[model samples]
Target: MAKDDLVSIDGKVSSLSGGGVYYITLENGVDISAKLCGKMKKFKIKVVVGDRVTVGMSPYDPTHGLILHRHKF
Candidate 1:
């Protein structure tokens, strides 16, 4: 399946900081800090506050979603 077609999720970017970490507010009202993997960092992609993005969960913690896709408002 295409990446976009995966079981993606949506959340609002709460904050973006140096070193590539971002705080995102999830639809369920929880917040999580996520960063792109080392490979994704090379692309210089940035996720900003209030922007909607897609994410996946870490295997250890499926409840927490990690930013995997982003769409501009």
Candidate 2:
């Protein structure tokens, strides 16, 4: 897919599910299911509930996405 086909959204992790999946609530109030990207796993990046993250969602399906980046602070 082309780079422009993906949409990046900022959200806070709301919960953790089985198999390393996370449920995040976007700033606009949309809830989406996300999974950590390959690089995150390779780097051993930990994602916890309440952590802020950037999710890369497909414009065609906003209900699911991939957690791209974690905001540290």
Candidate 3:
């Protein structure tokens, strides 16, 4: 699917796991696994528990997504 076809959602980092995977809790209370995007990895962005982040995922699969951006506030 094209980038535009992906849905972006706001969530908070709930836990860290091996292989750079993270569990994020969405606004509706569901948790999904995500991985840092290349831009964030290249910039060395760190995401810890309780940090708000923006996730991009396909509408068909909400269980996994890419960590697109980190919220400053």
Error of 2 at 52 (Å): 0.4
> How does model 2 fare in lDDT?
0.92
Over the stretch 14-66, how does candidate 2's per-residue lDDT look in tens digits? 99999998999999998989999888999999999999999999988889999
Please identify model 1 stretches exceeding 4 Å from their true place.
Answer: 1-7, 37-42, 62-65
How well is each residue in 1-73 modelled by candidate 1, as lDDT tens digits?
Answer: 3333434557888887787778878788878777664445667776667888877655555454557777866
TM-score of 2: 0.93
Backbone collision tally, model 1: 1
lDDT of each: 0.68, 0.92, 0.92
RMSD to the true structure for each prediction, in A, is 4.0, 1.3, 1.0
Residue 64, candidate 2: C-alpha displacement in angstroms? 0.4
**Minimal lDDT window, size 10, model 3:** 1-10
lDDT of 2 at 26: 99
